[model samples]
Target chain A: MSDNLPASLPGQSDRVVQVDKLSKKYGDNVAVNDISFNLTKGEVFAFLGPNGAGKTTTVEILECLRNPTGGRARVLGYDVSKRSDQAQIRKRIGVLPQDFNAIDRLTVRENINYFGAMFKHQLDADKLIELVDLKDKRDEQFKKLSGGLKQRVGLAVSLVNDPDVVFLDEPTTGLDPRARRDVWGVIERLKSQGKTVFLTTHYMDEAEYLADIVSIIDHGQIIASGTPDQLIDTHGGKKTLIIRDAGEEGLKQLPQGLPKAELRNAGDIAIPLHNGELTNILMSLAQTPLHDKEIEVRRPTLDDVFLNLTGRRVSEEGN
Target chain B: MRSRIYTIISGHFKSWYRSKSSIFWTIAFPLLLIVLFGAIFGSGSTKFDLYLQNQDLSANTPTYFSQGYITVLNNTGAFNLHVVPAEQPDPLTYVKNDAQLHNRGQRLLVIPLGFNATVMSGKNATIQLYMDQSDQASASLAGIVHSVTVSYAAAIAKAPNHLILQQVGIVTKNIRYIDFFIPGVIGMTLLTTGVFGAVNTNGSYRELKIIKKLATTPLSKIEWILGMVGYQMILATISLVVILFFGYAIFGVTATIDIYTVGLVVAASLLFPGIGMVLANFVKEAESADAAANAITFPMMFLGGTFWPRETLPDIMKIIANFMPLTYVNDGLRYALIYAEPAQALTNTLIALGLASFFIVLGSVLMNWKEE
Candidate 1:
């Protein structure tokens, strides 16, 4: 993660995004309630949440599409609530909304070139199309393209202005495994180009794999923020073990002094304990009649950390 | 910044040109309508199939009265009259049923009892006119029938002994269905290009999370929208030109207004559809946007004189038509094309268009992309 972080960030001189006690309200409900966070250039920050968490609201306010109800948000040193600086901020930032949409009737090449022209320094339209690997279907209209191709084209369009900070809100929500990997590749490429990537994803794997800093948000507030490993460490120590067929008699005979234990299931269960207990648990299981049973152990993942902290899996929360 | 704006504008234009089937509807199809409808309907050879039911046959039937009506109908050449006398085996029932089933635009003229006597007695008689108003194809025939009948009665007044032929003016001569349709079709095509085509794409891109990919780029929403609009506008403009050129050439539609007025009209035209862009902000789904557009478009297509003259419509319907953008466009374009007016008063139209556009953008501003 340190290798991915720039030695000197683009907006390290000044904060690119400043959310000073920002709050967004929709009627009686608080969508983004008193949330505050800042983004510097060349940082890959992930906003993690379940579906319907105020992640979208927060992002949209920063995009200048919606106004913050309780506090102000400034993007690229321009106040978002003030309409005068909107165009300026908009010109500098690229936002890939949660949903993928482009003119379905337009051809791939047409879509790319049109979007390319929107930026301050236009990309080589043909080159951009080629970059997305949509050159083969350049003449084919948007409606004719497959979902992955459409998303690729959409990415090409977002890069049209060569923006400084890019916001990707749940970029890979509906994509299949391969298509999702393709999107990840696109992000990796953007990151290599020294662009700041702001991402929102419900997939813990995605947060763990892609994001440099992951911020877990719930009910319009940030619950936790840190590197994926740090987050997991803060929540609990590693080494989660799962064992099946710990029969009623065997369970009674089990060792009394493991550091941590969680009955994941009534019969088949998972226990998170220290590294020293493994040999003792295994030796005890061998001595008992419960031999040749399902037993597995692995390092604690981000998902385990999230569950440990929130008492719910990341997948169950708002994305 | 200026270059960025240009690039954004171009992006939209390119996207629109690439994605929208705008060329099909705006250019190719409208041109086809110009050629097809113009050739079929513009020749002034459109003859109405009329069934005349003669009910009364009495000795007291005035010789001048019956002859007078037939004379007027025959001379107008708008109708091919088929006289079905009451004495024939099947009476009103058969004719009424057949007429109803024949088609939507055919007219059945029923001459009731004491019809000739009523005319000779110098008393007003009410003739039941059954019109298939499903479309305006037979609108002129219905009007011609009414006029000739009135003239026959008038002829009787002027010359008590001899019937006189009075010329009825029906100036649907140079106008074809396509010519009549060009304005609304053009405007509708533009509306679809911008609203349905452009806005839907923008909304869905965000919805599908495609924009999420762009969220890493320097490109902004304004730039994206500008690029999109520019792309679509180019295609729209091309389509408009094709529709106009074909409509004029094939249908003999001579626009009345000068270039400046036409420019103003074209400039003002963008305002109404700007609302469509604004609506994109509020609409979250393609299905809803499509439904909303169709709901508004269908009525405007009919009531706004896309196929018929507002003057011929009922007073109430005409009044309702007044508020529609297509009504103003149709009227203004007709004045430019048909009447060949020297100059068009675009101030009011421009203002209306400006207001509509402002509201649309306003609506866009109010749209919550991430609704609570």
Candidate 2:
């Protein structure tokens, strides 16, 4: 840890963030129910949830942007509830709120420097530009940049202060697939530098790919918390054999006494695979006329884990 | 803290200068108004505004000689005559206030009682002409009045020496419409820039989550407000310098930049943005807040003596103008920049500063620096 950081309390030297039964309420509505979590030093923690799942509320609480109605939270060994500690938290943390945009008329470098000047010890704007790979567009005005380039600038701004932990709220929410991959690459660079990051996203693949530890939140409650593999192993159901483009005719042509098979969207036939049944499934399929069709075994991902846990699939729009 | 504030000021300034619309409104638009208004009204020779009070009345009507003299004066076509009521107990004071309100020269012509009797008996009759000796039009206007009185007396009674024109001096500023309008343009520019600047920065910045981003930094709400007010002061200074220079270069309108002028500028910088901040708080969306700003500033601009003198407005509009914040700014700028009336300037500046304090504090208090 840098010498600028305050001496951590006992048993919290490695913990960058600590939350105990944190709750936030707006009159009769509970935006964040009782939730406990911890973020250790140098770990990228992803808070996974759909839209309006209280992800922003909880992160804003840690950011000292909002007051929790109940319980306690600490960031960088400082209490977020205390007035003086909020200042310390502000100095040590960086935030990219949902739908952030820089000044429209300022160039990318100027915008970076503009936000950097807010901190006493800001990192070099050029370095952040290179890190976000926006050097070619450094002199371009923010309004003239593409959406992806603008998002990259936002990422650069969030790291300008050389913050202890950066909180990126839905940073890639509206980005295209390529742009999302680019932002993920930047986050990967931050991980390589061993900088702690707190990311919130409705995209399960984003959380599963970028995070060391993932917490799934629904209706203001933490439904599950573990590593991506652990959560998938615990909640994600059995793997399935997918026969591509096999319609109802393929299902009708299946061999007798086979496991139950179902026809899915796009004329694909799905058959659940139990343990040690790959060879038997393939052998039974070899005698069938549908054997010539393309076939593959797929492992369960976070999408299935969430569907299994909540009994509902979060759509692409996060509804 | 200072660096952060400076950064915010520079950032806003950069945005302002870079935007074409902002430059047009802040600099070009005001200059255009000055040129357009100056071209239209600056070169023309306006008629001397004269307030006429015919006190020589019988049965609520002017007597023959007095009525004939008034008609002769009207036929001269050198004066725009406004009739004061014959029963006005203190017509001089009334004219003084009304003249200042309308940007008119303080010149009142009073025909006294028994004028018809005195003239008919071939006795000496005096007509009172109340005007400021220092008025630029005083000498020419007095000569015309003297000529008209002698000619009317000769035509009416064939006694040219019977009518005497007595001049009573009153102090008033000799201000032209352009002189009055330049300060108003300055005030108008200040109003639009300060209010809309704040509205755009606060409303759209909030919408863009810029304020949210700033809140996560070490920068505080006070620093941000100070930065905004600082930028407003710079813009106000630029508008003042540009408009005053344009006024001087085009129409030869001169102004004095005294302490009160500075005070008014500072007050305007704080006052209008403060109002914008309050408006932004109530109306969250950027476009709606812009509409609200327009709704606020348009009435203040039209009613606050921007295009014309407020005294010419209807009684209710004048009352409403008194409550408008821009009134004091316009009046203060006129007093300080053109009229050179330090005392009136001081009064308006103090009032403007007081309002600046109230609104700025209210806005700062109401501003949502952090999310709840």
Sorted into a CAPRI-style docking class, model 1 comes out as acceptable
Clashing pairs in 2: none
lDDT of 1 by residue, A200-237 (tens): 88888888888888888888888887888888788745
Per-residue lDDT of B29-111 in model 2, one digit per residue for the tens? 99999888766665534899899999999999999999999999999999999898898888986686566445578899999
Q: Which candidate gets the maximum lDDT versus the true structure?
A: 2
As a whole number from 0 to 100, the lDDT of residue B56 in candidate 1 is 56
lDDT of 1 by residue, B280-311 (tens): 65576767877776776678767876666665
lDDT for residue B237 in candidate 1, whole number 0-100: 62
In model 2, how large is the Cα lDDT of residue B212? 95
Over the stretch A87-117, how does candidate 2's per-residue lDDT look in tens digits?
8888889888989999999999999999999
If you assessed candidate 2 against the hidden native complex, which CAPRI class would it receive? Answer: high
User: What is model 2's DockQ versus the real complex?
Assistant: 0.86
